[model samples]
Target: MATWPNAAIATLMETCGEAVSNAAWNAILNIVFPCPTYLVAPEQRLDSSRPDLTVYIVGENGVFFPFEGKPAKFSWEKLGGEVLGYCIAARPDAFQGYNYGMGGNGPECIICEYDGANMRYLYIHEGELCQSDKMHVLHIFRDAAEILNVLEFVRGAHV
Candidate 1:
């Protein structure tokens, strides 16, 4: 896959243009990810529950990432469990088999939590939902360059 880290972020920022709602973020992602390379589906059902956004690889049945967006004021602790549940329900095989430091063989799925300005990356490790301190929290405005890395990782291209 081609890597255009800055390009994706730039498109997202341009599309949203400071808008912070879940719908706005979803729209930005849809514009950023088009079709063939990725399919961005909103309010997709993962088992009996639905996540705010579900990204899938082109022609693939499994999910690449499950995303949940909220306002900037929402508490991470309260929303963390819900995002984790969606990841588990959406891709049980990847979540259950994920192991820390296993390179490309590690978990391929991610649960993305973003609030207008900030974004959080969550993954399943050793039967528990965890976030690395380094990438636990990312700011959209300040960390524009790094956003591409997050997108690539979630797309299973950086694993």
Candidate 2:
């Protein structure tokens, strides 16, 4: 993960709606990668649903992670439920989401997935877990390890 400027964080914190949040989140994610390794597609439409963003590994077919996005304030329950639904619909091992900020505390991430036949969801602020189905949260963008893990998941899914 790149070290983002405080100004970027401030803009995200002030984002007022789903659209702005998604756009900002998309821009940040693109900046996270140098392109051609993994690609972040905003508002990509799938057959069953349209995810707010879809992360894809280049040159790999059918290997993608669908994601939802919400502004600073939103229904966590709603985000969790929708991501889980995406998991079921897309039938991937996992799904993800981004909340521009969580109650103005900072950005949060939501991950919903099947863990050995049991489904779980996590709401994370930075690297901290708030509402969780597991002992830890999926802090997708918190650090390099976390970002690599997501890439591994995407690659492993199609293998």
lDDT of each: 0.48, 0.51
Which ten-residue region of model 1 has the weakest summed lDDT? 99-108
Cα RMSD of all models vs. native, in order, equals: 9.7, 6.4
Q: Model 2 misses residue 42 by how many Å?
A: 1.7
For this target, which candidate reaches the highest TM-score against the unseen true structure? 2
Off by over 4 Å in 2: 1-8, 11-15, 31-33, 91-106, 121-159
Clash count in backbone of candidate 1 = 0
- Which sections of candidate 1 miss by over 4 Å? 1-19, 27-34, 93-96, 99-135, 157-159
TM-scores of the candidates in the order shown: 0.58, 0.60
**lDDT (Cα, 0-100) at 107 in candidate 1:** 9
Clashing pairs in 2: none
Q: Which candidate comes out best when scored by lDDT?
A: 2
Candidate 2 per-residue C-alpha lDDT over 28-116 given as tens digits, one digit per residue, 9 for 90 to 100: 55755447778877656656677777766687654255677776656667776666555555534233332111111125554445443
lDDT of predicted model 2: 0.51
